[model samples]
Target: MIYSEKVMDHFQNPRNVGKIEDADGVGEVGNAKCGDIMKIYLKVDDNGIITDVKFNTYGCASAIATSSMATELIKGKSVDDALQLSNKAVVEALDGLPPVKVHCSVLAEEAVRAAVADYYQRKGIEKEIPGCSGNCSCCHLHDEHCGGDEE
Candidate 1:
């Protein structure tokens, strides 16, 4: 599989490829099963602006490029704006991504959302987890409502 030149450039010379030791928030996503993992670090200013963003990823070239480009795109944006960034935008910014590798961009987007959510959580705000709203089954099941077993 040949990656686009844009993807190759970013992957070969990834920007913001390290961590922010004192990041305001950090997000980690994906797992062994998914064959990709991304860790994002963010530094937000008092005005809710993202003064800095960075990522460390273990995955394919597209995943690395997406993570790198996504951080670069959000570094100077407000947290809210950064959170609104979609995988499509990231893929488009990189020109385009192949179908099978599109999920890498999705992972990058999710990592960003996860980081912003972590920031809000730290600030005592509620987070809207995708597909798991309002006292999710996991929450109810683990909170003694199920009496430790379900018949």
Candidate 2:
């Protein structure tokens, strides 16, 4: 299969490749079956500005490109604004991903949202999240506690 030059460049020399040991939030997504896994680390300031972003991913070329591009797109953005990022935007920024590889971009978007959501949860501000009704047990559960009522 053909790959874009940008994709090749990113896959060869991905940016923000390492983990943040004490990140403000960390998000991990994708399963082994999908052939891609992404972990995003973010550092947000008191004003909710994304002061830094980094990622570690294991996947194919398109997945690496998406992770690299997603980090670049979110760093320095407000948490709210960063949460607005979509897979389409990442794909567009990368000059378009192949149809079969689109899932990589989707994973990137989900990783960012998960990180931001974790940040909101840490601050006890889940209600600020768009579309969150603040009623789920997951919203109020304390750190290290599981209140989802699954059991």
Candidate 3:
């Protein structure tokens, strides 16, 4: 399959790779349909802005690209603005993905939301992530990530 130049660039040299031991939030997700997994780490400042972001993904090129692109999009942005990010945006940021690989972009978006939810969970705040629940096409694409077991 033909990949976009941006996709190849991000896949070959993904940004924000690795974990943050004291991160304010961390999120991981997978796509069972293709065994693609993604992990996102975030450092949110007291003002509720994302001071830093990173990701580690084990999957196809699109999966890795989406993860990299997701981190770049959210870093330095407010948590609320980050939540506004969408899978479609992720795909578009990567210059688009193949029809079969669109789910990877969805996974990227979920990784961010899941990590933010984790931050809320850690803070003892009960939060709800819209477009994250129910039987949406992207929601159906999830594989749990907090456990760290790759599938």
Tell me the TM-score of each prediction against the true structure. 0.83, 0.83, 0.86
Provide the lowest-lDDT 10-residue window in model 3: 134-143
C-alpha lDDT of residue 129 in model 2: 48
Model 3 CA deviation exceeding 4 Å by range: 31-33, 133-139, 142-151
Best by TM-score: 3
The whole-model lDDT of each prediction reads 0.80, 0.78, 0.81
Comparing 1 and 3 on TM-score, the stronger one: 3
Best by lDDT: 3
Which ten residues in a row are the worst by lDDT in model 2?
Answer: 134-143
Tens-digit per-residue lDDT, 1-151, candidate 2: 7888888888888888888898988877765444677888999999999999999987889988999999999999998898899888998888888888887887788788878888777788843545333222222112123334234
Per-residue lDDT tens digits for candidate 3, residues 40-132, read: 888999888999888878888888889999999999998888888999999988888989888788888888888887777777877788766
Query: Model 3 compared with the native: what TM-score?
Result: 0.86
